[model samples]
Target chain A: MRLPRVEDIEKRIPRPEDFTARSRGPATTARVGTALGIAFGICFLTGLWSHFQYSSPGWLPIGPNPAWLYRVTQGTHVATGIASVPLLLVKLWSVYPRFFLRPPKARRDQLLDVLERASIGVLVAAAIFQLTSGLLNIVQWYPWEFSFRRTHEAVAWVAIGALLVHIAVKLPVIREGLGASVEDETPVHSDGPSRRAVLRGVTVASGLALVLTVGQTVPFLRKVSVFGVRDGGGPQDLPVNRTARAAGATRAASDPAFVLQLKAGGRSMSLTRDELAKLPQRTHRLPIACVEGWSRNAVWTGVAVQDLIALVGAPSGSTVIVRSMQTRGAFRTSELPGDFVDDPRTLLALELNGEPLSLDHGYPCRIIAPNRPGVLQTKWVRELEVRT
Target chain B: MRLVRGLLLLTGLGFGLWGVWLMRDFTSEQLVSMGTFLAGGVLLHDAVIAPVTVLLGVVAARLLPGRTRSVAAIAFLVWATLTVAFVNVLSGQGGKPDNDTVLHRPYGLSWVVMTALIAAIAATVAYRRRRIAGPPRSR
Candidate 1:
């Protein structure tokens, strides 16, 4: 069939220049895009690390929870995600206009547009599910009747995959957009807000988010944190009998007495199970946040691993290894980096909710470090080794 | 400019502070669970789905003309549906969280082998096509 001639189509179409813009600015949407990109990257990495824990254990170990290490990494991952909400909204607002504008120069650009549009659809869906799901997880709420573990796992894959596609499609455009600005004597103009102004707004909002998150997480400002307390509540969150995690049963065996081996910098020392019980213990209530986006808080009591390591003569800046009675033919080890071991609040927790550790809860011994994810905490402790 | 920097700095600082606060109270149980879930998902997805998806994509691409996008979308839908089903199966036990139901095994051996095979084949086909097409006309 013969197609309509260009002259014939002109009657139905608006002028070409009407759809074209000489330049685009760093609108609020653009800034939000940048922020979303960055936040997504952080969440992606953390999520990936969380994934790696299952695929390749010890690849990136955070000290067990209630430990400073676990809390920080896990919390940061959540905080950045929370902050991304505003950032994503603004970025979408800025970039939404581009959808209406005519395609830019090049066939390659057209193809990229196709890829990017699809990616945007996927990204938006994934982000909404991931973010809201994650936030709900923090508060220990599950609105959906679906399986949290499976749905979380599936959504995470979709989200990450979409994210990768989005980045692949947008990278060049982002680079060009940024590069073009530096090259132009006078920056390009568009109908939206100026790039610099939008960026300024993002910068302020992000800063405020940080402050608020910190205020909420920091122990000193717990009373002041607008974001609320870090804990997600208590034991109801933990599985009743999640199996003796390799060494979980050992914790009970050590009840009358427990030994916590402290190793650092290639040196190792042992504390009698009873002696470990005798040491001064610290207890703090904090939330255990997972990358899967679930969180729980409980009263944790234990000798600070940092303190115990010091007592056993482990030097500062030594990597610590926490081993559980739970083993998979040598796959049951978790590493605590030297830096994390030195954090003042790192702990060798033995009690939960002011009581002795339950057998299922890594009884007798477990490592609780702050700001670290839950996976890094080794339960049913048998040995602690420190290395530089 | 300062405003932007201030914002970024503030954001970073906020992360830093939140991190520090989390550092204050540490528990081993939560970490173990988090690690388990995270690792399980990554391993299953990377090792299983990635390879299978790529294989399906390649096969579909070869069979259907101008249907690469559709094939990819199909692959994703299939994967999601399977995951939902698998996770639900796992979730049948008493009081398991919704997240743990579907296991997207890491796309491991499958991912590596499939990706390598797909890349090699694609490269070979492209090379042959270029050779046949010969020199291009100047635009």
Candidate 2:
């Protein structure tokens, strides 16, 4: 007996033509593709905004006034990603026929088919990577060794590029399918629901996916957001990513001998937590907009970073590097740009809401800046090196 | 239109290839693992998930006649999509150790309740469709 080749096995399996559902056609594919494309666009833009928080490229300037800008962008990123899951599935299923499509007879047409198939494969792979990696990241699961943030950003460009190429290739088909009525599309013989039914099903599924997990950012919906990763419950009603125990900062942060080291130029000054608190205190109600997309606004009272740096003779245009007492982690120290240092609202926060900072909330002191990701908040501050 | 299409294709290819090129410095292991995941997702969906969905639709259609067929389809769409989206959460990984608030709900129970809720809604949809069409009439 001859060995079965991959193609032979594939031929035995159900091809796209085997799917006789009325929903699996050009009309349904076009409609779902339209929705999925929009979702992908929104997700891509917002994801870029969130990624900028980490790299801070000079060309794209993000302001501090809208303390909720990162909140909105990151929130939209995760939510749109969640919503896109169903639409993506539906879109792929509707186009499953393309996988089984044979090459054309002419050499040029065959070449074009091969190129289209290759690009489609790349697009599908990149899209799935972006969504799945994002979902896994939010829950802090790293099954792979590669850096999620770096890999995610790199793949995002690939995905968007492939999407644009796909649009270019299918523009005529898309226009034709979209322009004509769904009822008028070329259909395979089937005993299934109308195109409208499939569309409605996809919409409802996508919408459910959104509302079910968006409560992490939209506070009011927390109760109904059954699958929301972060419930917005922690110290001072703020969610915690790295706690005192988790960071191994409990003992070091609680030490009475602890003094925040403030350095400017070649000089350094030290102040105890109480002394830092006794200095001119300012309160800024800023949101701890975490990278994981959970955010909550809290009233934080502490010494302004500028004021503390001023005592050490660091001027208005100075940049400060906030260092944490946390024994372990990637963001042990974060550099605040001149703009952030000059911002009057930036504080080395000592209190949260109306109460003292909980151990999990970076007790003693934490950096709170408007429109900043939580990781850079620099909890359990041990040093502030101001450079003019 | 030709110019537009060409520009789109070139820009897309240029940018995409550049991105892939930039990551050339990643360790061979990292690259391999990344490729595995990227390719794995497409493979799993195309080979297993899509076929399973098609099979489910066939089964649902055969088991239920008339309008209830649509009900089964919609219900499966909602439940399967949501479940897959929250697969990590349902897998007990969402509730991390030492953190009480992250994915705090009993997800297994949540999944059960969610399934029942979907079934209930599906039953209602089936009932309404039955009333609207007043049962299947022979051709």
Candidate 3:
């Protein structure tokens, strides 16, 4: 008897399992990547604008509120870049299986399939390098010999270009995907979470990372946040004693003590130059490697970054990035590798060669590292980012 | 391929451990001396290689006409490859670099060149399609 065949029975089943497998496709990753790419665009444009402002001063279009605009924009640029990390990671994971597919069902489909796969690969690689390198720069780590500062600037251009192509190529599919109502093609899956559910998870995770990262950098909540305070204390990277003495021995002689303000953990706490001198001091010799092709080792006397972070009630994390203040006018920041941040010996120095810091020598404060570039050891630091 | 992947993983692990070992062996004072050489590598790559590659790709893209798309794709491959190579060189990672250089070097640069090339190519393609659609002009 032609009692309803398996096909007929399957039609009536209305299974959720069908949707699960089908949902894992190029479009999913493309959508996720597209969102991240747009975010990347915002960060790139903001960073570039900030770079111009720093380099040329007044070249950037100044909005109505000129005073706080640079700070806000640069802050946003960094925040968004850190935030994009998880989004990029999830997007890549989503599209990884697509790389193994056979020829597409149609010729046009095949062309698109290849383009989608290629773009995803490039995007993932670029995103990883940029994010990792940028993260390292903040921590004052330069494990790789290639100029992180130059490489960062260069790769940024490349990432932007790839992102544009990725957008252009996927525009049609994106339109189609957006056009389809969620209810219309909802398929059911047996073994795994639905695509919608996975996407929601990704969004939540990325959001959490962003919130934590942003929270660490902002001045209002920084003092109490777990990331820890920067205290602008570190080994002076340059020869401040010689410089100050060379400028005028009399001025050096008159100054009984070098004064440096200790501000760390997003202005959670502050210690004036006089205050820092009153505290029992600690000195350590350290190396300063700069991506700009120079290195200096000097005795640094000041407080440890971790100690300051602890004092301000900031949480010391597994990773932290230090922004150097040496190139104040240029958007020049170096990364301290994650391992060094974990080290107990790292310091933010107040003095070099038994004298207080000089202006050219990252006066008031500079990072002194067991192994870190001078660029990563920021001078006049105003903020620090710590990630657990 | 799995064996190769395994080998690569082992090599990477070895290098990382080696770096940690070196750090542990050297006193903080000696690290400064090591940093001097390390910083030179960072500077050379950042200042010279990165900017040169970008400039080279831009010039190449301009010269190649319709071939710009392919060249742009090739350029990114070149850039990423060079980066990895230079990084390894500075880190003093042993063994010759893999031929996957073709794939790795160009990833970043390809996107830039390809985007410009594709835009120009698409515009040219569209314009040609439009011209052909109209009646031929009299000679």
True contacts kept of each: 0.00, 0.59, 0.00
Chain B of candidate 1 vs. true chain B, TM = 0.41
Model 2 stretches with alpha carbons more than 4 Å out: A1-15, A184-188
Best by DockQ: 2
Q: Cα lDDT for residue A374, model 3?
A: 39
Ranking by TM-score: 2, 1, 3
lDDT of 1: 0.53
Q: Regarding TM-score, does 1 or 3 come out ahead?
A: 1
Docking quality level of the chain pair in candidate 1: incorrect
Model 2 pairs whose backbones collide: none
Candidate 3's docking class is incorrect
User: Any runs in candidate 3 off by more than 4 Å, and if so which?
Assistant: A1-23, A26-31, A57-65, A104-118, A182-187, A223-388, B1-139
CA-only RMSD, every prediction: 18.8, 2.0, 23.7
For model 2, report the TM-score of its A chain: 0.95
Steric clash count of candidate 3: 51
Using lDDT, rank the candidates from best to worst.
2, 1, 3
A1-388 in candidate 2: lDDT tens per residue?
Answer: 9999998987886655666777666678888999999999898888888878876889976656678889898899899999999999888878886787666899999998999999999999999999899898898888897888889888988998999899899988888779867673554575566788788888988998899899999999988988888888875788889888889899999998999899998989999988987899999889988878788888999988889988988896588888899988899989888888788889999999989899888988999999998888899999999865
Residue A213, candidate 1: how far off, in angstroms? 3.2
TM-score of chain B of 2: 0.90
lDDT of 1 by residue, A76-165 (tens): 676677667556544543443454455668999988777557556655655666665565554445545444444544556556556555
